[model samples]
Every structure is written in C-alpha cells, then in structure tokens.
Target chain A: MKFLCLECNTAMEFKETATPDQGSLTAIFECPDCFAEFAMHMNPWETQMLKSLDVQLGGKSEAAQPMQMVRSFLNQQNPDNLTAEAPTVSTEGGGKCPFTSVVAEAFQEPVEATGPVWTPEALARLERVPSFVRSMAKTGIEEFARENGHTEITAEVMDTARGNFGM
Target chain B: MKTYKDLPADGGSNIIGQVTQQVNRLQQRLASVRHIVAIMSGKGGVGKSSVTANLASALGLRGHSVGVIDADINGPSIAKMMGVRGQRIDYGDDGVKPALSPLGVKVMSMDLFLKDDETPVLWEAQTQKDAFTWRGTMEMSALREFLSDTEWGSLDYLLIDLPPGTDRLPNLVDLLPNLGGTVVVTIPSGVSQLVVKKSLTMAKKLLNAPVIGVVENMAAYVCADCGKTEDLFPSGHTEEMARQFDVSLLGKIPFDPRISIASDEGSVFVDQHRDTPAGRTLIALAEKIEAFFNHEV
Candidate 1:
C-alpha cells in the first residue's frame, strides 16, 4: 500500500514500524518532498494478515530460512527433533528491518505490570508445555489467575486455569 | 496529483519481490523433479491418500525416485500411510530433509510435525476470534513451505495428495503454475461422481491442467472365500463420468480390507500384497501415470 502526501502531491516512503501495541501495528511514512511524517495504524486483523503472508513490512535484509513460517508461527509442534530451534536472526550491523523485530516481538507475551506473578513451580510447569504454545499458554494462565483474583500464580492456580483451557 | 502508477514501488515494502523470491525458490527446488502430479478427490472418504501412498511405493519399486507431499495441511494422513510418521526430519544444506518411507519414497506432511494423534494444526495467533479472515492464507503458506522448503532431491515424480475439496486444485495451481497433471479419484457411486465431476471440471476446464485420468476406487468388493466381485456402490457411474470428461478410465481397484489394514499399520498395501486385486491395480495405476507423462497414453 502506498501513501501520498496531499500537500506536496508526492509519494511517501516507509520510515519505520513501531513495536506492536496490543496487537496493533503502527507504520510511519514520510513524504519525500515535504519531509512530513504520518503514521498508519493497522488493526489486529490487518497485522495478522501481514504476518500470515510471512513478509516483512519494509524490505527484508536477510534471506528467509527454509520452513521459516512453519517453524516460527506453528503452535503446538511435536516435541521431538521436529522442535529443533529455528536459527536465530542476527540483527547485527543494523541491517535487518525494524519490522522484522516487530514481527518477532508481536508473538511474544507482553509484560504487564498488573499481570499475576508466576511462582517457581508454575514457571517450571510452564516450561514443560511445548515451546511453541508456551507463551500463549502462559498468557492464558496468567490472565486466568488475574481474573480469579490470584496475584501469585502457583501450581494450584495453574491447575485451576487448566480447567478453563480444557487441558 | 500523483496516481498509483506514478509511484515507483509499494513504498519500499517490496512485497512483489519477496513473493517472486518465494516462487523462484519453489521453482528451483522442483527443478530436479521431472513430473509433479496432484492426486485429488473432491469427495471425502474416497481413498485418495491410500492411492497416493501405494502409487509412490509402486513407482519406487520400479526404481523411480518418488516424493509425496501431503498437501492436506489440516488433515494430513500421507505421512502416516507412507510409514513416515514420527520420523525425525533434519535440516540439510538445501532445506529440511523429508522423511523416508520403507520403500524409499520421500514424504513431507503436517502430520510429521504434529505433537500427537489428537493434536490439531493450529497457528500461533493473538486471537482466534476472527481467524476466518486469515486461516486459509496460513494454510496456503504452510503448503507453499512444504513444497519449496523440503529437500526433495532428484525425484522422478512428486505427487501432491490434496484434501477433499473442489477448491484445492486452484490453490495448488496458484502455487504450481506448471503442475504436470491431476489424477482424479472416485468410487463407482453416482454420489461420488457428482462431486468428482466438479473436480474434473476444475482440473480440466477451469485450471486447464492435464487430466491424467480417473481411478475408480472401491469399484467392487472381492469376496475372500468365493473369489467373486460384488458391486459395492451400484457400479458403472465411474465409467460414465470418465466418458463425459473424455478422460481415460485408468483402473478399477476392488475393495480390499487389507488396504485399510495396511494403511492403519503404516504399510504400503501394494508392497506387501502385490498379487492382490487392489495391489495389482495400484501398481498398474502407477505405470499408467508414468505412461501419461511419457506421452504413451
């Protein structure tokens, strides 16, 4: 999608993308002629559509790895050798696009100040969950704990959350 | 006032370049494969995966290197039927190595990556509330990865076993513009043909891919003791459908309980029971596929 600056009647260039906030992505575009910047906020569905396409918002600096989309986005994968860790992306030399990091960070569970704290036992159990779904499960369990008025997430809290998850 | 065409590019996103790279990777990966065929049955429960597994084995037994892609992303069964389930896939220089069946056919399927029998394929999403908007695209991306990122080296034939839907072929054709041909599978029942005809039209007219022919699965049931064949589904509709489509009736495979048994046991039926009625037909079906590519049929 292209953005045009009405005042200058010139096309805008992609400047950078901010880290997703609550599943929404904000991309900043600047008019080449006027040097004026504008932000485009994409809702959750649009963000997901971009993620599903497996393309970076800005130009990709590095070549994509084999099965990158499946390895990165597939939740609840087999724990066998099939769970081999995807190679880490090296953002060294500042060559990688900022949107690449945004994409990676988008899937991560946000650290909220009011979120329930995980006890040692609960954290260990969360580790046992398949790595792919571990973040999602942790988020769900913490949300459940908070909803149930539990400030500290212990094994009992995890057990109580398990019922909500049908696990 | 500037227009869309006035813009040099999509504001440096280079989305088209990235997509072109994806297509180039798929074409480069498939360069070594001589023929790529898609086996599809619009109607469910028609034994399309069974036919694919046995056909790959048959071709492998004939000294032809074969690879099978379980394109049915959500309901993949080819890896299990080909006896490659639970096999560890490693990353190679080219791509992720595919699982090898007993008869040496390479196999790639979502089944190989699933955690267990009961685990369903699910993508990591912030919310599945409105997944209908992007789920199909996710599945297609998975299929594209299976096609381009698997290390299927120097194959004589690569058969893609598609899911039960008339819309699947068009999705595949979008990914593989030069897909060799399509082998339509159906039972002898008119109900089966009713849906199979839509797939036939999809492959023949809509997409314009070559229709290799039709295979009548479970055309009849062979009695083990009496050695008599009984019509399983009011026979003769497959022939009528084939005549209507102007495609050859490739083979008629009788219903053999062992075929199901073998699939459940993760064994190729044709390999273990080559002399059986269904086994013989499966082997012949593979030969017919070869001939179709060679311009002999």
Candidate 2:
C-alpha cells in the first residue's frame, strides 16, 4: 500500500527511526514534495496485525518481543500515572500479565471454548514446544477442537487435532 | 495477584494512541541530528564511554557538529567524562536542550537526570543490589525518552555510546536504524579481544551494519616526562584482531595517566590534553573517522 504524506498530500517515502528517547520505534513518512517528516509511534496492534498475516515485522524473535517499547511509549505521555503507580510497585499490586501482550496476534489468554478444560497434562505438553512456535500450536489445537465441537482437549483430542492440524 | 515485578517497569493498559503522539514528538525533536553512529564494546570496563567522549570532542575539534547519546542507560559515564557529570537538562516550550560540553559538543546521558554524582539511578522502584538487575527494556524506554525529549539542533554526526553488550539492548537496533556504522573499541589483551570480537560480530551479524573500524584504547602508555612510549600490549595482536574482523585498525589510543585523571575531573582527555601524544593520535583518529564518513577508503 502506498503511504501518502498527510500534510502535503504527496507521494511520501516511508521511513522509520527510533524516537530520541529510545522508548519506541516510529514509522516516519517523509514528503519529498514539501520536505515534511511525519512520525507515528509503532504500536503493538500493528505488530499483532502483521503476525496474523504470517508476516515478521523487523525480524525480531518472538522469545523477546517489542512489548516493552509498546508499553513504554504509552506510559511516557502519562507521567502523572507513573507517580500514582509508584506506590503500586509492591508485589501485592500486581501489574498486567506479561504474556498477554506477546506470542501471537490475538495476544489474549486461551479461552475455555465451553467444551472442555485443557488438563494440566495437556497444557504441559503444549508448553514443551519451543516458545516461538508453542503459541501457534496452542491456537491451532484450540481452533481444531472448538470447530469440531470438542469441549475439553484430552490426549485423544490432542492426537486428532495433531493429525488434522499443524502449527 | 500480580505485582509490578511480574510485568514491565511500566504497564500499557490503554494508551496506544497517546504513546503514538509522544513518538511523533520524539521524531520531530531528533530530526536535526544526522548520521547516528554507535560505539559499542561487548565486554564491560573497556573504556568505550571514555573513547566516545573523547571522540566526540575530537570530532568537534575537526569543526564538525557532533552530539553523543549515552546509550548505556544503566551505566552512564559519557556525561561525566565529557564535562557535564552533574548537569541537569533544561526542558522549555520546545523540548529538552542537551548539555553543552566544554568543547561545544552536545551530550545527553542518564547522568543528566541525577542530582549528584553519587546519586543512584534507582530506575527500578523496588531496587535490587546488583547493577545487572536494571532491566534492558526499562533502560530502552528511558533511552527513548532521552532521544525524543532532547532537542539537538542540527548536527553533523550523532555518536551513540552503546552499553556493553551485543544482545543486552536488542532494542537499540530498532531505535537507530540509519546508523552510519559502528566503531568497535577494545584494549590490546587476549581477554579484551575475545569480547571485542563479539562486539564486532554484533555489528556484522546482529545489527547487519558496517564496522567502521576499531580503536585500541590503552594500547600503550606514554611517559609524560621523557616522551618515551611503552607499548604495553604487542601491536601485532590488536592488528590481527582488526585483520581477522576485516575492519581497519583506526588508531592505538595511548594510555595517558592524565586521561583518566581528566575524565575523573569531568574533562574530555582529547580536549584537555590536546598537546599530548595520545591527544594528537586521537585527532588523527578523528580524521580517519572523517575519511570513513566520506566513504574514502
């Protein structure tokens, strides 16, 4: 897709650079016609969207994703929230789940599917998969099981899903 | 129940739009600075920050507009060495104005935020005893803030003094995409070269950028009284490291006792001791860098 410069309405060259603060990467649109450079914060949604389409944005491994930058960029604008949250630094005031903003496009906790709960054994089996691909495998198994009207994923259900689906 | 330790230093609940706006502001702030070149050494205690501070001064001596971003978020020594150790930044209507060094080079570092030289960078709220516990992601965000918030009016070269690691700050690759290249620093020792090689690998493999060359710091000790030079480490060893890495051996920065003393005194060695042998070599090293910048082999 051609990215146009919003200010000049001209054909813009897409450029990206890290913000000076090193908080997050910014996608810059440089307009040759008007010499205008526009940069926007690179957000998690874009990364998630790219992942869903089987695209790797910037070749970073999933093991250590760009969640920090996504979170940092958001927090920088709201510095007041920082002091307020400072008192919440204790273990009791636990923050968001680390894995929620990672792994795949959905970036959400696995749902129960209203059919069957994945036993601890099954979850352990899935966890054994390499981190980069384990999430992919889980999404595959869950989808296959849910579509076929299976409530819980047992060893037998896993075998059927494995035969029918691959991450 | 979860705590801050379980998540990132700061959490992103529902502020994607606001974050994007800050990013735009950061880009605009750094638009004037050009050709960001990072200096890194894989291993710590290799004098990378000292080399960076002096190199910025050396470049300024050559009449080029230069600015340095101390990318060593946890261990910020660039500001201290460059004569702005305890200086705080000025934030006005436009943005943060980087501290001016004695030799007119712009410097931005985590040190600028500290109230005093002894102040601990308690970036982590529930601080840990070990310095290594400073999260890389947290440092990366702080770095992002330094870059975005600092207003450096157009510069010829922006040298980034990267922290001592190839993998430690992986986010640096994304932060400064158009790095002119990297200048790897090392001391002439088997141990130093072993780690320096990894630093070279970081640029050639990880960052996929060019290795401009290597500056062998503490390569020799020059006697101030008699002008006698003692090559502490064999010259052939450092040369071989450069040859094996396929990068130019830029210069051997002599270990002038005054260099460290000057750094401790909040001075750029090259600027304070310009008449010394090491200082002259640093200037020549700056010329070599200039030649590389011009794409002249």
State, as a TM-score between 0 and 1, how close model 1 is to the true structure: 0.85
* Model 2 lDDT tens row, B46-67: 7888888888999999899999
Every model's TM-score: 0.85, 0.60
lDDT of 2 at B60: 98
Q: Candidate 2 at residue A87, lDDT?
A: 12
lDDT of 1 by residue, A135-163 (tens): 56777886788678987888999998898
Interface RMSD of 1: 5.1
lDDT (Cα, tens digit) per residue for candidate 1, span B1-297: 899999888887777766765667677778899999999989999999999999999999999999999989999999888888999986676568899999999999999887679878888766778999988888988898888778898999999999999876767877888789889999988888899998898788766578899999988999999989898889788888889989999999999999999999899999999998998999899899989999897
Task: Give the winner by lDDT.
Answer: 1
Candidate 1 - CAPRI tier?
Answer: acceptable
